[model samples]
Target: MKDIEQYLRQNKPETPDEGQFIIETNARLSNVEGIKGTVDAERHRGRLMLVIALVAGLVIGCLFTLFVVFFPVPSIETELSAFSKAIVSLKEWEALLLVPVAACAIALGVFLMNRKKEVL
Candidate 1:
C-alpha cells in the first residue's frame, strides 16, 4: 500500500493551485449560515451556463431520439416501413400493441412530471 501510494504521488498529474486545490477539492462542502459572502460572480455565471448547456443537450438528445422513432426520414422510410410491417405481421396482437402502449406511457410520464413541477 505504501509503495503504491508513493508511485501515485510521484506520477500523478499536477494541477494548478496544487495545495489549495487539494484542500478545497477534498474538503467536505457545507453551507455556513450567517456568512454573507461574495466571490467571483463570473464563476457562478459560468456554472449556470454549464448547467444550461448540459440540460439543453439532454433535451435535444431526447427530442432527436423521439423524432427518429416517430418521424422516419425519407431516405430510411422504405427500410423503416418494412421493419414496421414485419413487427406487425410476426408478433401476436398483444405483443404488437405494446409499442404504441409504451409510447403512450412515456408521454404520460413526461406530462405528469411537467404537471407536478408546474403545480409546485
Candidate 2:
C-alpha cells in the first residue's frame, strides 16, 4: 500500500483548466438549453398535430360511416334513378374503405400516444 501510494504520488499527472473554462462551459450549456427548449417545443407541437390529425380522421370516418349507413334520402321513382344507381354501386366497397381508414387512424393514434421518451 505504501509503495502504491508512493508510485501514485510520484506519477500523478497535472490537468490544468483554462481561466475562462467555467464561463465557456456555462455559455455552451445555455446554448444547449436553448436548443433543448426549442426541440421540446417542436416535439410538443408535432404531438399535438398528430393528435389532431388522428381525431379528425376518426371523426370524419365516423361521420362518413354514419352517413353511408343510416342516412337515406327519400325520392320518387320518377326522379334520377341513374344517380341512385351509381351510389348503390359504390355501397359494396364502402365498408372495405372505411375499415382500413378507421384502422389506420387508430393505429396512428396508438403509435403516437405510445411513443417512447428519448430524453429524461
Candidate 3:
C-alpha cells in the first residue's frame, strides 16, 4: 500500500489540478459506497426485527383469543326485567379474578417449561 502510494505520487502526471481532483473523487466515491452499505445493512436488520415482532404479536393474540373463548369469565348484571329475572347471576369480580389467574397460569407454565429445558 505504501509502495503504491509512493509510485502514484512519483509518477502522477504534472497537470496542476488533476491529482487533487482524482483524490477528491475517490474520497467521495468511498463515502457514498460506505453510506449505502450501512443503510442497506440497517434496513435488513429492521425488517428482521419487524418480522419477529409481528410473529410474537400474532402468537400472543391467538393465545388470548383462545383463552377468552374457552375459559369465559362470568358477568353480573343488575338490570331486572320479567324476562331477565330467570337468568343466573355471577359475582362482579369474576373477570378480574380470572385475569390474574390466567396470567399466573401462563407464567407458571413458561417457568416450568424453561426449567425442564434447563433454562433460567
Candidate 4:
C-alpha cells in the first residue's frame, strides 16, 4: 500500500493548459446561457398566451351570461320544436353543466400557479 501510494503521489495526472481549459469552460457556459435564455423566452411567451386565453374566455363567458340574463328565453310549452326544447333544457341545466367546468378551470389555474412557483 505504501509503495502504491508513493507511486501515485510521484506521478500526477496531466491537465490541459490553463488558457485552453478556461476557453473551453467559457464556451460551454455561453452555450448553456443561450439555452437558458431561449427557455426563458419560451416560458414567457407561453405565460402570455395563457393570460390572453384566460382573459378572452372570461370576457366571452361574461358577455354570453349577460345576454342570457337580459334576454331571457321564452317559457317552454307542451308543444315545442326540437331546437327550442334543446335550448330550454340547456338553460335549465346550465348551472349543473357550468359548475364542474368552472371548478376545473379554477383547479387548473391553481395547479399552474403552484407549478410556476415550484419551478421558480
Candidate 5:
C-alpha cells in the first residue's frame, strides 16, 4: 500500500493551464445562469396567466349571478313545462351548488400554487 501510494504521489496528474480552466469555468457558469433566467421567466409567466384566469372566472361568475338575479323566471306553477321546472330547480339551488364548486376550485388553486415542483 505504501509503495502504491508513493507511486501515485510521484505520478500526480497534470492540470490544465489557468487561463483555459478559467475560460471553461466561466462558460459553464454562463450556461447555468441562462437556464436559471429561463426557469424564472417561465415561472413568472405561469403565475401571471393563473392570476388572469382566476380574475376572468370571477368576473364572469359575478356577471352570470347578476343576470340570474335580475332576470328571474316566472314562478307560475299552473303551466310549468319540464324545462321550466328544471330551470326553476337550478335557480333555487344555484347558491348551494355553486358554493361548493367555487370552494373546491379555490382550494385546488391554492394547493397548486403552494406545491413544490419536483425535478427529474
Candidate 6:
C-alpha cells in the first residue's frame, strides 16, 4: 500500500478541461434542482390542502359535539320514544364516538399521504 501510494504521488493524474467540466456539472445540477423545486412545490401544496381539510374537519366535529351537548331535544316522548331513548343513551357514551372520529381523521391523513405519493 505504501509503494502504491508513493507511485501515485510521484505520477499525479491530471484532468484536462477542468473549467468546462465544472461548468457542465453546474449546469446539470441546476437543471436537476429546478425539477426538484417543482416537485417540492407540488408536494407542499398537497400537504397544505390535506392540513386544511383536517383542520376544517376538527372544527366541524367540535361544533357538532357542542351542538349535541347544548341544544335541547324536542319532545319526542310520545311519538319517537325509542329514538329519544337511544339519543339519551348515546349521550352517555359520547366519548366512545371520538374513537371513530379519530380513526376517520387518521384514515384521511393516510389516504392523502398515499395519494400524494402516487401523484409524485
Model 5 segments beyond 4 Å from truth? 77-86, 89-120
Q: Highest lDDT: which candidate?
A: 6
Q: Give the higher-lDDT candidate: 3 or 5.
A: 5
lDDT of 1 by residue, 32-104 (tens): 2222222334345445555655565566556544544564434434565666743543342444445555655
A best-first ranking of the candidates according to their TM-score comes to 4, 6, 2, 5, 3, 1
Model 4 Cα lDDT, one tens digit per residue, 1-120: 999999998898997569778888999999999989977876776677577657756775666556555555557655787677658756776875575467557756765885575477
Give the Å shift of residue 66 in candidate 4: 1.3
Query: What TM-score do all the candidates reach, one by one?
Result: 0.31, 0.55, 0.43, 0.58, 0.54, 0.56
> What number of backbone clashes does candidate 3 have, counting pairs of residues 3 or more apart or in separate chains?
0
Lowest-lDDT window of 10 residues in candidate 3? 84-93
Give the per-residue lDDT of model 6 (tens digit) for 1-62.
Answer: 99999999989987676868888999999999998998887777777767766776777667
lDDT of 5 by residue, 34-76 (tens): 9899778767766765676577667756766666556556665
Q: Root-mean-square deviation of each candidate, in angstroms? A: 18.4, 9.2, 13.8, 9.3, 8.7, 7.1
Over the stretch 19-98, how does candidate 3's per-residue lDDT look in tens digits?
68888999999999998897776666555555655565566556655554454433423456423432222232345446
Candidate 5 achieves a global lDDT of 0.68
Off by over 4 Å in 6: 1-7, 72-114, 117-119
Q: Give the 10-residue window scoring lowest on summed lDDT in candidate 1.
A: 30-39
The superposed Cα distance between candidate 4 and the true structure at residue 75, in angstroms, equals 3.6
The window of 10 residues in a row where model 4 has the poorest summed lDDT is 64-73
**Clashes in candidate 5: how many?**
0
- Clashes in each model (backbone N, CA, C under 3 Å)? 0, 0, 0, 0, 0, 0
lDDT rank order: 6, 4, 5, 2, 3, 1
> Looking at candidate 2, what is the lDDT of residue 75?
46
Can you list the residue pairs that collide in candidate 2? none
**What's the lDDT of the predicted structure labeled candidate 3?**
0.57
